[model samples]
Target: LEAINLRERKIIPAIKKGETVVLDFSHAITATHSFLTALLADPIKILGLKSYKQIKIIGANETIRTIIDF
Candidate 1:
């Protein structure tokens, strides 16, 4: 609930650009924020939700941010 509120208010702190975040949804769904926008963020993935669009439908546990260098 808190995270949703934070995101809604655009008060998210600096999360790493290459870290997998599994949003917690154990709180009230009515007040919880959907992790959709998160999917578009770099190094971010919408956990616990079905993958679609540009998101991959892999297991949350297996999902990770891979930064490649050449």
Candidate 2:
């Protein structure tokens, strides 16, 4: 959770600065709902859906992609 929070802190600032943030999940096999939420919740809440425009996700498998989409 602390690590997730630290990543979120970095991500949010980059987004705010209008930089494109790429989240590469290339070798990750899966992710828990709670983990995803912890990583994304604050950015969504603070920046709204517009945050999606600044963030890019790549290399997630089907299941992980589905979870993120959901």
Full-model lDDT for every candidate: 0.31, 0.81
Clashing pairs in 2: none
lDDT of 1: 0.31
User: Which 10-residue window of candidate 1 scores lowest in summed lDDT?
Assistant: 61-70
TM-score per prediction, in order, is 0.25, 0.86
User: How well is each residue in 1-25 modelled by candidate 2, as lDDT tens digits?
Assistant: 8537755678888988888888888
* Cα error, candidate 2, residue 3 (Å): 5.3
Best by TM-score: 2
The residue-by-residue lDDT of candidate 1 on 1-70, one tens digit each, is 5335554333233232332334433342222113434323322343222222223323222122221110
RMSD each, Å: 11.6, 1.6
Q: How many backbone clashes does candidate 1 have?
A: 0
